[model samples]
Target: MFRHVKSNLLLFLLFFSGRIVHAQSRAVSLAEALQFAQQNQLTVHNKQYNVQVNEARLRQEKAARYPEISGAFDMRYNQQLPTVILPGEFRNLPAQNIPVVFGTKYAATAALEGNYAVFDPERKYNTGKAKLQENISRNELLVAQTDLALEVRKAYYACLLNHKKIKLTLGNLGRSETFLRNTQTLFQNGQVQPVDVDRAQFDVQSQQAELQKATLNLNQNLLSLKYQMGFPLDSAIVLTDTLLLSGERQAVFLPDELKVEARPEYRNLQLQQEQENLLLTRNRHNALPTLRLYGYYGSQAFREKFNFTNTTEKWYPVSYFGAELNWLLFQGFLRRAQVQESKIALKIRHNELLIFERDYVFQTYSKLLAMQTEQQNVHVREANVQLAEKILNVTRIRFENSLVQSQEVTDAANDLLEAQTSYLNALYDFILARLEYERIQGK
Candidate 1:
């Protein structure tokens, strides 16, 4: 019995301490979380591999401009058969050696060789191709970064919006409880009708249901934010941002001239154009011949004894140095076809790029208009929330002074709660719309 009692006490103490710890825990801000993800997220790992892959490709391309060196050694054994025609002057090849190498023979040689390209137009364009490939890889990584940031921002704002909903729901529930108490007091004094008390009780119950739903929504969005930020399991935090739609706020819009020149999409297209030009140059260069210098030094030795007269004791040193031009006289018109194919692809990409620019401008223009409209909505909702608050306060005072019906107080409370929620939603929508605008513009 004592042991069980002690365990119960220990459990209570632990639960109480956990509550204290939770109360003291600080919330991680958005910027700090973003920085952590940059260093720790799985997407960063993928981007790192992408950079490494392009780096390897660049190295391979640059290596094409250098000389290649290689060496090899070979050893083999063989057997030979011979024929005899005359008795004394037999047509047998070296009768003594024929018997010596009758079953198996051994020969070995080792050599080192090298080749350096003296002239190639393709190599010149290859250098440029490698650099442009690096640029494309960098842009791709940036796109990933921007995408991840956008996801984080959306999740963060969602959590903020849900948190505001929870607060509004709780406030409504409290108001219901207070109004129910006032209605009961009035009934005890015989000032209000019994239906008034019933309606007030109904309001309290409805607000309780809404409060529960709002809490669930808040928890779900918290889970989403945790997933987006890649936080560890069991992390608990409360949002610290204020939930209010600003009444008067404005953004400085960029001019059309500056917007087109500074956008990432435009720069990406420009990079692609340069890369295609380099490829065309390479295809054109392929029509020319190539020149290279090849050299090798080798020696073959088979000297059982250092006797110069013996056939088995032969050793010689050999060296070679030469330059060669390799020209494909014809490939059955394949080269011409390839060049024409490349030219057509280049033109296609150019046309696609033109279409893309037009679409980008249209999209930017549309997003700007959407953001402006959302801003106006935010202002209207903010004003409504403020006015609703005043009405709820005045109605509550009048009910307390026996100057209003319980239904009037209930209506005012509901209106206030709805107004608060609408304003919060508008606040979230405006922020998200602006973020989308900025993201698409590559700000």
Candidate 2:
């Protein structure tokens, strides 16, 4: 009953799990898939935009350090108010002989202003912070690139494995059907029991069920790869690198220092910690006064010629050069509180940096162990598959000569199926292990 239910479930999955269209397909390469995923992934696209934004911001920050020049022209007209005499005993309106005059007044001014900060403790530190921020964004982009490549490789491998599984399942189904036909023929001749024919029929149905499941799984994996590559859902593609199961992507053992240096995520964290330290220093240095040397050279002009400077030049001259020092004497206690906050933040970042380094070390070691184990399994599983194939060949001859029972031949076939499946699984695991290890190593 359990077997029958399982078989029904597989049939349902085959009918509904994925869409099917029997059509010729084109092949996709690993490199092409990875490139397409990087270009099409929404997250990667966003990160690329963020890098541009950060670059613009850094340029603005750097520009702020240079001198700025601006010009302003102003004109104002005002009306004067008239003075009135008070009506008092000492100064009566009849005795008063005073004049009240109301007139308009105008003032026009034009000047160019320029300023440069010769020395500012904060600006100097802020420049470095902007650079570090740029580095952070760049590292974030690299991290996105690495993650997308890893995902593409995994998905590509999945589709390839699923295709193999479908083929394997279909082959098993054909063999089972053939076996059922042979058993029926033997039963008619009274050479085998009817029970053997029934069992052969059951095996054929079971293999057919598994084949359906394999077909469903293969199509689903293909769809997933298409989604990753930003291809149309109805589009058909065949993987070209089926025979290229695994390739060497790493050295036997890279130097620990090299991994630490090349890992983008690690460098990003290190930059963050440095930024935190710089911020803390800025907070502590808040007590230091900022000094600036500013100078401006401008010309003034009036609607009518003015005698302020009778120079032959058509414009009036107004130039000034000065130095100013500013110290934050008091803010309603804002500076002190900021310094305390920054110190606390720096402490938190320090702890986080420690944790990151520890985890990175652990991850590197774990990957190394996994890669070694997978390499060993590849060799062992390959040998097991060869032995199973040889055994199946010998059993087939014995069964044809009437020296072995049909059940014995069926058992050998089942063993061969298991061995082949086990070898394929081992190969797949080896690939997965290598990918995982590389991912951790940030290769």
Candidate 3:
């Protein structure tokens, strides 16, 4: 009995868990989709990592301004001692040359060295450029995030449009099936011919085929949306947001003038220009000398035997501190070449910034115009859909009263489907254009 109860409890838990999973698969809104994509998209995450890496580089550059300390422990054994010549005048052996082997057979050195740049133009420029580069990386991340959001939004809109098309197709399918039934009933009453029933049946089959196509298209679009959001393709998602074809656009919410500098691309270009300028300055200053301070404090031990543990052995202390000034008088014109290259690159970036501004303006205005046209088109298409729906309804009633033929009802259903599809397309176009405009504006 205990075993049976345990088995039943396991099955109950499994069923309850399945229900929880199903319930968790609720609808997602546009805002939620965009937020989720920004958080999870691989492209955005990679860009974020780039920002972090640059931040670390910035820290490294900043730390370069401080003193560098290092240590080394070296041991050497002399298999054959080196010989050196010495003057014997100090020993009252005038004009005599003496050869002597010096020092112990085994020697070891342990030292700590310190170096600080008193004034290095390269280091100074490096820190500045690193700061600028870090900012540029952050801006790049922003650009990635913006691009991801745009893609996710477009996918979401496509899914919504597809869903609407499927709904319309289903409705038309139902109508066609109903018409077929009515025609068959009329045939039974001897009011319609067999040809009318066959035609109605054909219309129903056509609608079913269309519904199948629409359903497949919807599935394809949903997969694209999931890919954009970095969501699992095997998971199901239902959009909670609906498109309103006749709704007003939010263009008035935007500023009249586009802020070109507000764009991440433009900001990156500006930073590049600044970094290049710093490079040029550094190259020019390369002609000047570099100043540094260096110090070494260490002790060296020497013994006849290899044993370092001998307490009787003496370790000599060595210490030195000095400032150095190194002047590279010339570099075979490499410095000049670098300066010239920097100038050319800076000029190129300047031109690029200008070109970007011009192009951005052009794109923004073009999208604005397209958005306006699509907005107008949406209203027109919406009106057509409503008219088509009315015509379908009227045709159905007339057919039931034996006033219209089966072909007329089929044509009405086709008309309604076409109008709805066109309406959805217009809405999709308008929303996309509006989104593009916002993106170009760097909003």
Write one digit per residue (lDDT tens) for candidate 3, span 1-443: 34335434643664485467558775789999999899989988998898899899999999999999999999999988999988988687989988888877999999999999999998988899888888988998999888888898889888878777767776776676667777778889999889888877777667666766876787798899999999988888878887643235433434348799878889988988898899899989999899999999999998888888787878899999999999999799999999999999999999999999999989888888888888878879989998998998898889889898878877887788789879888888888888888888888
lDDT of 2: 0.73
Better candidate by TM-score, 1 or 2? 1
Q: What are the Cα lDDT values of the candidates?
A: 0.73, 0.73, 0.84
Residue 206, candidate 2: C-alpha displacement in angstroms: 2.5
Off by over 4 Å in 3: 1-26, 73-81, 87-96, 105-110, 245-257, 300-315
Per-residue accuracy of model 2 over 43-72 as CA lDDT, tens digit each: 888998988888888888889889877888
Error of 1 at 428 (Å): 1.4
Q: Candidate 1 lDDT, tens digit per residue, 1-443?
A: 34335434543664476478569754767776676566667886688788888888889988988899899776554344334344432445444332222222555567889999999887888778878878877777777777778887777778877766766776676666666777788889998889988887788777767766776787788777777777764778655655443443555455344356456566678788887778777877787999999999876654333343456565566779999998877778877777788788789778878887787788888888888888888779879988997898788789778898778877887888788878887888888878888776777
- Give the C-alpha lDDT of model 3: 0.84
Question: What stretches of model 1 exceed 4 Å from their correct place?
Answer: 1-26, 75-106, 121-127, 240-257, 305-314, 400-403
Q: Please report the candidate that would top lDDT against the real structure.
A: 3
Error of 1 at 50 (Å): 0.8
